[model samples]
Target: MTTAPTPSRADALIREHRENMTISSWASDAVDELGRLQAAERTLQRLGYQDRGGQEWAPPIGQAPDFDLIDSLRSRIAELEASKNARIHKLEMQALDLASENSILKRQEQAELEVRKPLPLPLPLSDDDRLRLRSDVARAIWDVMREHEDRCGHALEDVEPKHQVWDCADAAIRAMKDKP
Candidate 1:
């Protein structure tokens, strides 16, 4: 005997609404399709698809593009810059102290001093270099969303729940940021 057919996205949503339940969470296909829709909206938004026609649409916690990667890289870059600035500040303070002594030898020493930070073996790549290496990987995530949009529809006006889409996407991003 043949098993019952899997529920379609439309059918699952309709049934859930009619039955006052949430089959979208339980049904695998429905969940996957919803994810795809959300991803498409996110991708389009990232690509800067604004609705001049006053249309609204967006994605939930869909595909993770370069956002996480770029954010992490930026955070690391900021930390490094702060640390480097602190080191520079120390050097400046030392220089100021030496200048106050009015000693020729101290002046000469300060001029000759070199702040050489330790370079690890195979020295770690500069932030720009590291970002360059990882950026392509992050950008590739958009293709997955694009594929979904092709199957569904790219424009937000074409999709349902247009107004709620952006809110969902914001919530998803907030949730991601909240996580360690």
Candidate 2:
């Protein structure tokens, strides 16, 4: 029996796998960004800046600034800034990985295309020849069906078989013939 050449199938599988990996990578990045944003907000809160109108100012100018409060706020801000930098680093790493993966996929596809050149078609068969071929296939299928029935000790009576399979096969053959 004829089969789809191995390299074409392999390339298709590889492309699908790469696509899934890319989606997963992008989801991971989104989660990482969300976590980073949350952490930044928490850090800001820890720094003692109440959410008053749009501005953040230390206690009124004349009300003696508390040294302890100032120090705590400064520390929190520093921690938040460090966390932000780390998040940025993670994003950069993800970008690099995506770029490398894209390059590899492109190269693999190009190689596959080069390896599988197309072939010329065979001459068309006469209607009689086609009918004979179909009959042969049907007989072979009947043999397999009989074997299956014997092996399972079950009649095919309960099966809800339909002509859909034949229709699909006809469509596929037509499609193949139409290909250049």
What tens-digit string does per-residue lDDT give for candidate 1 at 22-137? Answer: 45446877878889987977777785565444456433354546778989999999999999999999999998988787687776676657322222222365777545433432
Shift in Å, residue 105, candidate 2: 1.0
Give the Cα-based TM-score of candidate 2 against the true structure.
0.32
Once fitted onto the true fold, the runs of candidate 2 whose alpha carbons sit more than 4 angstroms away are 1-62, 117-180
* Cα-based lDDT for every prediction: 0.59, 0.67
Q: What is the lDDT of residue 95 in candidate 1?
A: 89
* lDDT of predicted model 2: 0.67
Best by TM-score, which number?
Answer: 2
lDDT, residue 66, model 1? 72
Residue 117's lDDT within candidate 2 is 38
The clash numbers for all candidates, in the given order, read 0, 0
